[model samples]
Target: MTGPATDVWTVMSTARTIRRFTDKPVDEATLGRCLRAATWAPSGANAQEWRFVVLRSPESRAVVAKAAEQALRVIEPVYGMTRPDDHDDSRRARTNRATYELHDRAGEFTSVLFTQKRFPTASELLLGGSIFPAMQNFLLAARAQGLGACMTSWASYGGEPLLREAVGVPDDWMLAGHVVVGWPQGNHGPVRRRPLADVTYLDRWEEQAGPTLVTEAPPS
Candidate 1:
């Protein structure tokens, strides 16, 4: 709510992954508001045993930055991330550039660590059923507040020990996600996505939800 109030549909439709950010820092009030939004998300069995840790101080962010660097080593190779030049105008190249830039500047952004209480019988994916919705709420709230955010895997990659030690996470808490938030240096989205007709199904898995779209419709 730090920014002007936006309609729900507009907010949902425009929300997209934002990796590039400005030098401006997100204030405490705005961050708290987004965290409040996260609390509104539903969890399996209504356990609501989620916690969020914020790293904003220089010392803490330095730790996050170190973790981000470690994560990039794993990310870059596996994803075949390449450095893009001024001449490179392709979509993939641009995306890669943004990814790298975010890692390089991670220390400057405010990072949030989301955690859920560990349950004896639950798998990680199953545990995510309780936490991912809260995380989504966090993302949407950030987008609504005119803040740019990107969820990172720094804590899940080779960074678990580093971040856990830096944040002093309890043994019972599992790190669900890491997200960086800041004022965007780039533009917001009219996000690109596949048409609904391409993804939806009707009453059954085998049924098409919309008219069939054949590429190059046979000579009319």
Candidate 2:
């Protein structure tokens, strides 16, 4: 288990997005703990309005997976539109291959659908502000506990309606995203990300230098 003071910088630095997972089942107790961690996340006015729908049963997983596949097929043409001709063809090929692998492996993991009651834009931002921290905590906790998980939003396309119907999500609720969790079967490593300097600004939003640091520094 990761200690409370395991060096905040180190924990943040080591976290990575896990895509591939193993067939090992995440136990009920562990899942509950993960949810508990999520609930601890801050929310708008401490409203804690977030709701997590865990899809564990084989039947439910099948329904959601089918819906996801259907939605992906519908969006494939649009995905092509976003790709540029100058893009790295090799990288795109690898990404496409991974997408197909995820499709085939989708049924093996548990799907968690996160939601919140619909709110106006400002309120929604506050609500999201609260939920995402908790989500990141959940992901970090999962990584610490040796579980592989990845946050994905592909289900939010045209599949939202099907998901709401299949999962019995309330009419007043809005889907945030889906998180897939399972034990990892393959290698997990540092993810490629832009440097901090390229993203962060000193004072104003646009005031940034060249790439700050490519890889995160380990805690001293």
The candidate scoring highest on lDDT is 1
lDDT string for model 1 (45-116, tens) is: 899989999999899999999999999999888998878887998999899989999999999899899999
Question: Which residue runs of candidate 1 sit more than 4 Å off their true CA positions?
Answer: 1-5, 211-220
Clashes of 2: 1
How many Å off is the CA of 79 in candidate 1?
Answer: 1.7
Model 2 ranges off by over 4 Å? 1-10, 80-92, 120-123, 209-216
User: Residue 101 of model 1: what lDDT?
Assistant: 93
What is the lDDT, from 0 to 100, of the residue 98 in candidate 2?
A: 54
| Model 1: how far residue 91 lies from native, Å | 1.4
Error of 1 at 9 (Å): 1.1
Worst lDDT window (10 residues) for model 2? 1-10
